[model samples]
Target: MLVAGSASPAEAGTGQLLVHLRSLLPGLAGALRQVANVILEDPAWASRATIVELAERSGTSPATVTRFCRTLGVAGYTELRVGIATEIGRADQAGWEVGIGADVLPTDPIDRVLRTLLAVDVQAMHETAAALDLSAVDAVADAVVAARRVDFYAAGGSAAVLEDQQLRMYRIGIATWTWADVHNGLTSAALLGPGDVAIALSHSGRTTETVEMLAEARRHGATTVAITNFSTSPIADVADHLLGTSVRETAFRAGAMSARHSQFLVLDLLYLAVAQRTHERSTEAFARTADAVAAHRTPYEPRARGGSARSADPQRGA
Candidate 1:
């Protein structure tokens, strides 16, 4: 599988051509980004266009087009075209007729807004799944399972996502802490050792605080992991493992909002993998936690034939 930081686009499979391109867009240099934009702007046309035609359209030389193809990890122009064609075909077969980038106007009806948002979120989830590296996830899971401690770092919406992972890990008896504050996160990271694990969450992978925290952890000899939408971001540089999320952002939704579901999907997979590895302990923890909260919930009561509520306990008769 194409582990975010380690693999090239060719390793990600042709089906993920568009997604890989989009994720790499932010990190590409000027001429290369222009070429990428040309293809992304009209994939169908680009898929069928010749190399010279693409160069002309992108306002770059044929050499630059060849460089763009090489940057994408394809052999040459032909392979790039084939990848785009395959991606387009796959999208068509999946019935993704709705434009995920459609704008939601202020005057639009609630249904239209709903449809646009749904399409964007669902497409993000699908793309994320398509590009995720399961082997990377398993490796991270194994690290977490054996770690002496795990620290999670993030800010804003990503902080909320990391909190969810923190809670899950805690419930399963894993030693985990979450830091939204940069200062505190750096302190925690500095204390981490070779047996520790540090995970940072960011949509763009460029969040300064989160990146710094992960970098600090790595410097302290901890295993570092970065979960983000862009694989080539600064955070990915310091991470020992990079997990990429493919998020489709619209004007109405920011990167963090668009990335929520996809981030959750990746974390859920990691959490489940960890749980599976520690099955006995995880089951025991679940049972203990459930019992601890059982008394806080009210018992369900059924309604009697006479339209009155009846308690299940005969001792507390209705």
Candidate 2:
């Protein structure tokens, strides 16, 4: 979710949104963890709620809510609410009722590449299934629901994944901070307060900077969540919550491409699970936000061709 990266106009918003959806850490603050928790408890509710209402429910100031909204990359609460509504619609109609299977066999060179894609993803997901800790995931989601602020620290390839988490959290109404800088991470952890949470990501779970930041957040009395591949890593061992991804590594694994994608999938699942539980508060926030948008919208010129008057054809959106 790097602001400078290629994101559609519809996808762009406050700086934090870029990181929220695309990556994880780029020097995020501690205030956003609480917002993440609220959204996680109920995505539909968060998507429908307003910033003022979100603040009231979370018991924070309006300014903090505004900052949280902007950080997640929406124009404001209204745009986020609308997007969340659509997401909820999609969720309610999810294809979970049907048998889900994706199997690809080799046909050509293109087919071979496709199989490679399938093979890698399938292997990783299977590993993820075996490696995941349900209690830890539920705890992380619950912590996101209850926290007053949220901070994410990711280094190496995981930083990009952290940003993606930020985006999904924002859509569901979470305020998250991401840190890519070791120095800035210390600054963030040093500043964390009560009702806040910290998450750290590392495939090896051995990054000195990431662990250092987690330690700092702990010192500041913040809840800690660790997402990593190794269960015995220092961060994971000390974390209150631990979520994992298992990505099979091979000699061809350069640029950390396959592993990063798996990381993203894991992050998405976590963000959505949290959203599923906190639908009520999120809904109230969205309603307030939608009303504000309706009140503030301004008229714009119609899109017409050849300098002629546009036709009043609502059927085709004239």
Candidate 3:
């Protein structure tokens, strides 16, 4: 069976909790999926209803409900209620600031707009991180480390993320290539075989080009990994491994805005994991690249009056 998201489980926060739960759907089966669907379809019910009532609504037995709660790492039904209620109270206290489903509006104040955009993107990153299957991440890391070459395919906003990954992996001295165009992606994928890795990024998991490229890579015997929002989409069908991100779209905050942020979270994790596998080499490569680039750039200096200057070298971030 495919492993689902969530490192352990989560106050912990039912709104966020529900997001985590939905990510686990790909790994659930039978009545478990039913119970999860019920709670997800109506979180107010999860926060307020009785266990027996939830069971009835889910069309499952009380035993199954209890099992489901346990699977989520809650002690039992009561704890689930407390957790959901805590999240509800937290949401109420946050007022409109949580911004889980709110959209940016032209009429809104600048602070409100900033808060909404930041809140949604921040929540997406946190939730995406929490829902990641570390074991899947590890497997991808292993494949990356062992592969002779890695090719990445992504279109639109996802291509920006792929470019970042390409740069990062290359900095660490790993052989990497990326293509944002369908023809180029397919051409690169055709050259991949047994020891190669092909990673495709698509928020909708239905991108025709990415799906076809991944399929072609698999046909050529490459290990395929898909980073996407939907676990069961056509892209996932062709991928040997699925890395999922949960990003809900608002009117103004579409896939390009928040979904790209979520995908970056996954890519950062994957990149770091690959780096960790080759710690000494990765460290040396980064230092070498930094030194090489530093020679070409002007030294950091405070701006003089009415003059501009570049920022300082990246110190360890706080």
Candidate 4:
């Protein structure tokens, strides 16, 4: 939950709303879900519309809208409107604001689709970064750097993110491995001990396989970290450190689109923190790794594209 006075002006309006929406989406139901979806579809109108008007637009009643507002921790329709209006005002002030809840319909042109995709992804990253708890991130990074071994458990799209993180840590000389198969992941989790770190990535935080591995690792006394969209999920309950991403599922890109990007940003943030701690080793690893692959690539050829080209020396190749 966002604190009363924690968010800055830039982050207070739409940013906090996105956070709430992402967090509460999994639990929304019935007419409340419809109401929430309507608000997401058009924030500016939602901000200014009366309760009765919102109800008419959403195909629900004013009482249902009030119930939805209460679910979001707002006093009533009036407070909800105030919050939305605040976001709309702030968004208007910014020249290049993107709506987090915008969608790409099948009827949209290719260019329009591209614009919507880019806008939503960019907004998700911004909101995720804005809502990130840096202190928790620092703690997770410290745990990773100090761990005897690190195991990443993920599946589906999140599994891809896990593999990328594994490669990144390996490049920096940190011992990390990820498993896509649940049996293999569970087997790996079984070997983890008190000094080991187990990180789980799930969008809904309810994936049984991911949750089981995290539980197993926790049972074995490993420090557990969860990266997910919902903070109140089962994984969050078992995790020692929680890193959340605020990315809503759009009509076209529901499974892993914006969420994956947010996950990557979190992983990158953690990786950078770890890299900063062991700078010498990381730099040396980069140098050695670079040299190992340097001979495989063909050197630049001069005048291949009719540009200025004179030198063939490796350092000054065109």
Per-residue lDDT of model 1, residues 1-318, tens digit only: 233455565787887888888888888988898898899888999999999899999999899999988788888988898999988787767766465345678888998888777776777788888888878899999999999999999998889999999999999989999999999999999999998999999999889999999999999999999998887788888998988898866777788887898999999999999999999999999999999999999986777665556454567756
TM-score of each: 0.93, 0.55, 0.74, 0.81
Residue 71 CA displacement from its true place in model 3, Å: 14
Q: Compose the digit string of candidate 2's lDDT tens values, residues 1-318.
A: 222212322543221122132223222346565665566456657766778788777767668767766665566677666655654454345432211122233444776656666655665564455335566677778888888778999887778789778766765577887898999988988999767999888876678888989888988889888776555556665576767665544445632555676677678778778878888766766576677778678767575666433464445444
| CA error at residue 250 for candidate 1, angstroms | 0.5
**1-318 in candidate 4: lDDT tens per residue?**
333212322344443664666566667778988998888778888878888999999899988998887677676777787777765564455543455457888799999888887777777777788777788888888988899899999888889888999998999899999987889988999999998999999998899999999999999999999988876677887798888887878886775666888889999999999999989999999899989999999887566345455543446755
Off by over 4 Å in 1: 1-6, 305-318
Model 2: weakest 10-residue lDDT segment is 95-104
Each candidate's number of clashing pairs is 0, 61, 0, 0
For every candidate, C-alpha RMSD to the true structure in Å: 2.7, 21.7, 7.1, 4.7
Give the deviation of candidate 1 from the true structure as CA RMSD.
2.7
Error (Å) of candidate 1 at residue 41 is 1.6
Q: For residues 205-293, could you state the per-residue lDDT of candidate 3 as single tens digits?
A: 77898899899999999999999876656787788888888777777766656688888889999999999999999999999999988
Candidate 4: pairs in clash: none
